[model samples]
Target: MATPEFVLSLREKIGHDPLPLVGVTAIVFRDEKVLIGRRADNGRWQPVSGIVDPGEEPADAVVRECREEAGVTVRATRLALVQQVPRITYANGDQVDYLDLVFRCDWVSGEPHPADGELTEVGFYGLGELTDVAHEHVRKIALAVAEDDPASFVGGR
Candidate 1:
């Protein structure tokens, strides 16, 4: 997993302090299937996701992450969910709190494969038959699956 250059630069100044960042998840779909990948770092199955580069559109980040991590071409159809992820402390001692933007994407072309080393395996699975997936990711997939549904805002008022 390549750390974005901007993050590395920030780390130099912040050290291990908690940093707020924006991230995006691409819940790519094809018919009845959803794209999933086994992350190389944690071996957890998840939707293709990555940090939003500075000044990059969140939707564009979704497309880029899917291609770079899963070897698939996808069109981000809609924003599915917005939520604040719990703070995560990396093995390197960096802490981050991410504002996650989840997008529902339609597969345009290409078969799923681990194009980059971030994932060990990549493939599509039936939405109802998913296994080895974290509960949070499963929730994201569920919220994104219905095309007519409005995007979910996890917290409110």
Candidate 2:
């Protein structure tokens, strides 16, 4: 299945339109493992993330994305990082500039499974095993899980 037509239409309408899009991502860890999703579109591993809806807090969006992508309910502990990646080019040739807020979250309940169609697989992985992650920032977030600082956000280097 492809992305819903509504989303595609919206993307086309807003392509290069110069609007601020807010998104949220969650770094969920258990023991030494971090939850990651294999994106069906790119076949690459990344954290659970999605666009933040209007009027919703970034923390709420983080929890919602965790539940939707990883099939787990998580409680966001704190805002970990704010990333501003200017001009991201998508696979479809559209460009999006975004301000992303990442949160440090912990699983509160639910089982691990890929609930959203965007993810082909879902699992917890150790730092040593994450060789094929989609981006360096994601890898940094995974490494941050091992650090003593719980409030650190791994902004893009």
Candidate 3:
């Protein structure tokens, strides 16, 4: 897993302190299957996700992440959810609070494989075959595929 240069530079000053960042999750679907990967760091199955580059569009980040992480090309069709994830304290003691933008992407081309070292395995899976995936990701998938789908804001009620 490569840390972006900007984040690395920030960590030089902040050390292990909490850093707020924007992230994107690509819930890319090909027919009845959804793409997922086994994370190299945690070994947990998850959708294609990555940190948004400074000044980059979130939807473009989704497409870039899918290609960079999973070796697939996708069209980001919709914004599915926006939520703030709990802070993550890395093994190196660096902490991050991520505002996650989940997108529903349609597969355009390319077969899934681990394009980078971030994921050990990558492929499409049926919704029912996600027993190994995190419950939060499963919920994202459901929300992304719902018939009455619209972008959901998790807070601000």
All candidates' TM-scores? 0.98, 0.80, 0.97
Regions of candidate 3 where Cα sits further than 4 Å from its true position: none
lDDT pick, better of 2 and 3? 3
Residue 58: error of model 1 in Å? 0.3
Question: What tens digits encode model 1's per-residue C-alpha lDDT throughout 1-157?
Answer: 9899999999999999999999999999999999999999999999999999999999999999999999999999999999999999998899999999999999999999999999999999997778789999999999998997999998797
Per-residue lDDT of 21-60 in model 3, one digit per residue for the tens?
Answer: 9999999999999999999998999999999999999999
If both were scored by TM-score, which would come out higher, candidate 2 or candidate 3? 3
Model 3 C-alpha RMSD vs. true structure (Å) is: 1.0
Ranking of candidates on TM-score, top first: 1, 3, 2
What is candidate 2's local distance difference test score?
A: 0.74
Model 1: lowest-lDDT 10 consecutive positions: 124-133
Task: Kindly provide the TM-score of model 3 when superposed on the true structure, using C-alpha atoms.
Answer: 0.97
